[model samples]
Target: MPLALYMLGLAVFAQGTSEFMLSGLVPDIAADLQVSLPVAGTLTSVFALGMVVGAPLTAVVGLRWCRRRALLSFLAAFVLAHVVGAITTSFGVLLATRAVGALANAGFLAVGLATAAGMVEANAKGRATSVLLGGVTLACVAGVPAGALLGQLLGWRSAFWAVALVSVPAFHAILRWVPATTSAATGRGAGPSGAGASGASGASGARAGDFRARRELRALRRPRLLVLLALGALVNGATFCTFTYLAPLVTGPAGLAEAWVPVVLALFGIGSFAGVTIAGRLSDARPMRLLVPGGLALLVGWLLFPAVVDHAIAVFALVLVQGALSFAVGSTLIARVLYEAVEAPSLGGAFATAAFNVGAAVGPSLGGAAIGAGLGHRAPLSVSALLVAAAFGTAGLALAVRRVRARRGEPAGRTLTS
Candidate 1:
C-alpha cells in the first residue's frame, strides 16, 4: 500500500465523523435553532441527499481535472463547509452547510476509492478498498463517539470545529504525496507499478477521466455493473437501516440505559473494524468465500434482531457480529464494483458512490416511515431483512449474468465475480 492510501483513509476519517455525529446533536441543534425535532432531523436527511446528488454532479465536473486537483478541491470545500457549520447560528445557514459538506464528502469518497484501487495491483484491489473504507468504520468506532462527547461537553458546533481541525492535515498529505497528474500509469492497465503503470506507484486515484466523459456516462448502462450498483444499494440499505435505529432499539427494546447507547454503538464499530481488517486480508484472495457467509449471517442477524432485542446480552452480542458481517460483505461488494468498473475509470467511483448514498438516503427513510406509521423499532429490522433478501436476489442476478456471458463466450471483460 502507498503512503497516500493511508492519507486517504485519514481524510475519510475526518469527513466521515461529521456524517455520523449529527444524530447525537439533532436535539441540541433543534433547541438552539428554535426548530422542531423533525426539522432538525432533516439535517441528516439533507446530508444523505447531498451525497446522492453530489456523486455524479461532481464526477461530471471533476472528470476534467487531474486526480490531485480534484481531491484537493473537494477536501478544501469539505473543510470550509465544516468551518462555516461550526460558526453558523441560523438554521438555514447550517442546513446549506450540511448540504455543501455532504457534497464534498461524497466527491472525496468517490474519487478517493478509485485512486486507492488504481494505486494497487489488480490482485490487491480488495485489500486496498478495505483499507480505504477502514477510515469510515474507524470513524464509527472512534471519531463519531468522540464527536458526540465533544458535543456533549462543549456544544454541538464544537464537533463541526473538530472535524474541520482534524481534516487540515489530510489536505497537506494529499498535496504532498499524491501525484498531480497521470500519464501512462493511470488508465486500465495500471499494471505492475500500479498507479502510473510505469512504476510511478501513485495513490488509488484512477485516471478514469482518460476516457471521454460520454464513455463514462455510457458505463452506467452496463447491466452487470448496474446490478452490482443496485446490490450495493440494497446491502448498504440493510446495514444503515439497522444502524440508524439501533439506539432506540437499545433503549426501548433491549432494556439498556441511555448511557449504554454509545457503548453499544462503539461495540458495533469495533466489530466493523474487525470485519474490515479481516476482509482486507482475505477479500483479495477469496471474496466469495467471505461474501456468501457474511451476507447470509447479516440476513439472519436482521431476522433474529426483533425477537432477541429484548435480551440485553444477546442483542449486544448480535450487534457486534452483525456489524462485522455487514462491513465484510459491504466492503467486498465495493471491491467487486471496482473490479467491474475497471473500464469506466472516472465513472467507476461515481457509480459506487452514488449507489451507496442512494441506500443511505433510502434505507433509513423506509425504516423511519415504518416507525412514523406506528410500527415499532422492529419495523426497521424488518425493512433491513427485506433489503438484505433483495440484495441476495440481486447478487443471484449478477451471478446469472456472469454465467450467461461465460456460456456465450462474450468478451465479458472484467465481468462481475471475475
Candidate 2:
C-alpha cells in the first residue's frame, strides 16, 4: 500500500473520532444544554442526515477538483466546524456545526476511498480500503474512549476541542504525504501507479471515473446494487440504534457502574478493531465468508442483549462481541459495493458512505423514538435485532438470486464467494 493509504486511514481516524465520541457525551450534552435525552440523541441522527445529503452534493461539486485538493478542503471545513462546535453555547448552533462537519466528512471519505483504490494494484483495492476503514475502527479503539474520558473529566465541549486539535495533524499529513494527482475527478486515474492488469487498466489507470456522473447515477440503479445499498443501511442502522444509547444501556440494564462505561466502551473498540482487520484480510477473496458469519454474530448478539442486560459480566462480554460483529463485515460490504459499480468507483464509494449514514440516521431515530415512548433502555437492542434480521434476509435473498443466475448460466457480475 502507498503511504497515502495509511495517511487516509489516519484522516479517517481523526474525523471518525469526532463522530463516535458524541455517543458517550449525549448525557452530558443533554444536561449542559438543558435538553431532553431523546433530543440530544438527535445529534447522531443529524450528523448522519448530513452525511446522506452531503455525499452526492459534494461528489458533484468535487468533480472539478482532484481528490487530494478536495480531501484537504473537506478536512479544513471539518476542523473549523469542530472549533465552532467547541465554542457554541446554543444547541441549535451546535447542531448546525455537526451538519456542516458531516458534509465535509462525507466528501472526504468518498474521495479518499476513490483515491485509495486508485493508488494500488487491482488485487490490492480491498486491503487498501480495509486499511482506510481500519482507521475508523481504531478510533473506536482509542480515540472514542479517550474522548469520552475527556468529556467525563472536562466537559463535552472539551471533547470537540480535542477533535479540532487532533484533526490539525491529519490535515498536515494529507497535505504532505498524499499527492495532488490522487483523484479520479477528471476521468483520469491519479496515483503512484495503475492497477496491475495490463489491458483492462483503462487509458489512464483503473476502470475508475471513466463514466460520467449521470452514467454513474444510472449504474447505481441496478437491482442487486440497490439491495446491497439497503443491506449497508440496515447493517449500520442496527449497529448504531443500540450504540448511540450504549452509555445508558450499560449504566442501567447492564448494571455496570458509571465509571466502568468507558472501560466497557474500550473493550467494544478493541473488538471492532480486530473484526475490521480480520474482515479486511478476507474481503478480496472471501467476502461472503465474512459477511455471513458477521451478520449472524450481529443477530445473535442483539438478541442476547435484552436477555442478559441484568448480568454485568454477561453484558460486558456481549458488548465486546456485539461491537466486533457490528463492524466485522464492513469492508466486505464496501468491497461488494465497489465491485457492483466498478465503472464508477468514486460514485460507488460515495454511495457506500451515503448508505451507511442513511442507516446511521434511521437507527438512532428509531432508538430514540423507542426510548421516548417509555420503552426501557433495552429497547434499542430489540430494535437492533429486528434490523439485523432484516439485513440477514436481504443478504440471503442476494445469495438466492446468485444461485438462480448460476443455474440459468447467466453471468454474475463479480464473484463474491468461491
Candidate 3:
C-alpha cells in the first residue's frame, strides 16, 4: 500500500521484461549474431543458470548490507548489463552480459521479496509480496510483447536498448523510495509506527552482519522448509518447460500467425495477473487448500494443452486457465516456506527462490532437448504435463508429511494450505 511498493513494482517490471523478452527475440538474436537458433537459444538457458546461481549467492553476500542499498546496487548492475547487452556485437560478449544481468535479476528479486515482506504488517505480507510479483506478470503481458514488436520493427539489439532506457527511471525510483531497513531491523515485530505490533518493537536490535547470516542459514536447514523449496522448483520447472517455447509452438503446429503470438501470450499474462491477485489473498488465509487446487489446475491445463493448440479460441481459453493456475501457487508456496522457517524467513525464502530459478534453468534445457530430438511442439507440452503431475505428487507429499508430523505429536512446521 505504500508508495515505495509501487516503485519497487516498476523496478521489477523492468527486470522481468529484460528477463523474458529474450524468448521472443531468439530468432532475431540468432540472425543478428550469425548463429543457429538452437545456439542462440542458449541465451535464455544462461540467464536461468545465472538466476539459479545468483539467488542464494547474492543473498549470502547481501547479508552485510542494508536491504535498500543492496536492491539499488543490484538494479544498477542490471541497468549496466542491459546496456552492455545492447551494445555488444560479439555473441560471447552478449552472452556474458546477459548472464551478469541474470545474476542481478535474481538478486534483485530475492532481496525485493524480503524487502517487501519487511515493508508491511504480518497480516498484509501476502498482499505486499503479490504487488511486488505483479511486475513479473505485467512483463509477460506487456513488456515481452512490446519488446518483441520492437525487435520486429528495429532489431534485437534495439529491444535491449529500449529495456535499458526503461531501467533508468526504475533505478531512480528505487533509490528515492525504497527504505533503508536491514533484515534484522525490519523483523523487530513490525514497522516502526506500531502499526502491527505492541510494546517496544525494536527490542531485538540485532545488526545485519555475520551473526545474523549464520542464524538465518541455520533456520533454513529444516526439512519441511527444504521440501517447500523443492516443491517450488518442481512446479516452476513444469511450467517453464512449455512456457519458454510457447511462441514457437503456437506459430508452428498451432497454425497461428507470428503477429498473433504476442497477443496470445498477453492473454496468458492477463490470466497470470488475475491468478496472482486471487491466490495472494487466499494463500495467506489457507495455503494447503490453495495448493491442492492450484496443482490440479496446472495438471489439467497441461494435459489438455495438446488438444487445444490447433484452434485459436481453444488456445486462448486454455492459456487463460494455464496462466492463472500456474501463478496461483506462488504466494501460497512462498508463505509456506516463510512460515516453516519463522526464525529466519529471509534465507528460507531466498532458498525457495533459488530452487525456482533452478527449475527455470532446467525446464528450457529439457524442452529444447525434446524439440532437438525430432519431436515437435507436442513433445514439450506432454513433458510439461508429466512435470506438473510430479509437482502434484510433491504437493501431496508435503501434505502427507504435515499429517504424519501432526500425528506424531510434533509440529507440522507449516501447512501449505495454511
Candidate 4:
C-alpha cells in the first residue's frame, strides 16, 4: 500500500477517536454537566444523526469540487469543532458541537472511502478500503482508551483537547502526502499526474449525467443491494446496542472498578483491530462467507452476554469476542456494497457510511430508552442479539433472491464478486 493510503487511515483515526471516545466519557460528562446518564448518552445519537444528514450532502459537494479541497475543508471544520468542544461548559453547547463535528466527520469518511477506492488497482480495492477503515479500528483500540484515561485523570473536556491536537498531524499528513490534482475527480487509479491510470476512462465516462442517473436508479431497483445496506445497518446496530452502554455494563454488573473501564475498552479495541485485519483478506476473497458467519457469531455472543456478565473473567472474554465478531463484518459490508453499486461510487460510499451511522444512532437511542425504562444495563445486550438476528435474516433473504434469479436463468444483478 502507498504512504498516501496510510495517511487516509490516519485521518480516519483522528475522526473516529473523536467520535467513539465518547463511549467512555459519557459518565464523566453526565456527572460534570449535572445530567442523567441516559441524557448524556444522547450525545452518541446526536453525532450519528449528524452523519445521517451530512453524508449525502458531502457526496454532492464531493462531486462538485476537487477531492483534496473537499477533504481538507471537512478536516478543518472537525478541528474547529473539537477546539470549541474542549471549552464548552453547557451540555447544550456540547451537543451542538458534537452535531457540527459529526457533519464534518461524515464528509471526511464518505469522501475518504471514495478516494481510497479511486487510489487503488481494481483488484486491490478491498485491501485499500480495509486499510482506510482500519484507522477506526485502531482508534477504538488506542484512541478511545487513551481518551478515557485522559478524561479520568484530567477532565472530560481534556479529551476533546487531545482530539483537537492530534488532528493537527493528520491535517499535515494530508497536505504533504495526499496529492492535490489527481483523485476521484479524475477517476479511479489516477494519481497526481492523472495519466497512465487504469480505469480512468470508465470513471470519466461515469461523469455523464444521464449515465450516472441510470446507474443510480438501477442500483436502487436492486433489492439485493438495498438488503445488503440493511445488513450493514443491523450489523452496526447490534454492535453499538451493547457498546453504547459498555462502561456501565462492565462496571455495574461485571463488578469491575471504574479504573478498569479503560482497560476493558482497550481489550475490545485490540480485538477489533485484529478482527478487521483478518476480515480484510476474507472480504476480498470471500465476503459472503465471512458476512454470514460473522453475523451469526455476533448473534450468539450477544445472546450469551447475560449469562457471562456476572463473572469478571467471562465478561472480559465475551467483550473481546463480541467486539471481534462485530468488527469482522466491516470490510465485508464495504466490499459488498462497492461490488454491488460499482457505477455510483460516491453514492455507494455515502450509503455505507450513512447506513452505519443510522444504526449507530438507533442503537444508543434504543439502549438509552431501555435503561430509562428500568430494564438495567444487560437489556442492551439482548437488544443487540435481536438486531444481529435481523441481519442474519436479511442476509438469508438476499441470498435466496439471488439464487432464485440464477435458477430462472435471469441475471442475479450486477455482482462484482463471485
On TM-score, the candidate that comes out on top is 1
Total clashing residue pairs per candidate? 7, 0, 8, 0
Q: Which scores better on TM-score, 1 or 4?
A: 1
Tens digit of lDDT per residue, candidate 1, span 248-289? 988887888998998899999999989988888878778888
**Which model, 1 or 3, shows the larger TM-score?**
1
Order the numbered candidates by TM-score, best leading.
1, 3, 4, 2
Please report, in order, the local distance difference test score of every candidate based on alpha carbons: 0.82, 0.80, 0.76, 0.78
lDDT of 3 by residue, 1-418 (tens): 7787877888788888988988769998898889999899889878878888888878766665666667878888988888888888899999999899988888878777777777677766677777877888989889988998898898888888887777677666667766554442245234553222112224332233556678888878777777788878777787778878888988997898888877778888998888888877877777667788778878888988898788888888988888887888855677667556667755655776788878777877788899999999778888888877777687678778779889999887654444
Better of 1 and 2 by lDDT: 1
The regions of model 1 sitting more than 4 angstroms off are: 183-185, 188-211, 398-415
lDDT of 3: 0.76
Could you list the CA RMSD of all candidates, in the order they appear? 4.3, 4.9, 4.4, 4.2
Off by over 4 Å in 3: 31-36, 184-208, 372-375, 402-411
- What residue pairs clash in candidate 4, if any at all? none
Residue 143 of model 3, lDDT score: 91
List model 4 lDDT by residue over 1-418, tens digit each. 7787787788788889988888779999999899999999889878878999998777665654456766888888988998888888899999999998999989888878877777777666678788878899899888887898899999999999888887777677678756565443345644544432212345563354234444554665567678878988888887887877888998898888988887787788888887788777878777767777777777888999988899998888988988888888866787777766666676678788989888888887788788889999889998898888888787677778888989999888655355
Per-residue lDDT of candidate 2, residues 66-153 (tens digit): 5667788998999899999988888999999999999999998988887777777766667878888888888988998789889989
Which candidate gets the maximum lDDT versus the true structure? Answer: 1
Q: Residue 8 CA error for candidate 1 (Å)?
A: 1.1
Model 2, stretches more than 4 Å misplaced? 24-42, 88-92, 152-155, 185-211, 371-375, 401-412
For model 2, give the 10-residue run with minimal summed lDDT.
193-202
List where candidate 4 sits over 4 angstroms from the true fold. 24-42, 87-93, 183-186, 189-221, 370-376, 407-409, 414-416
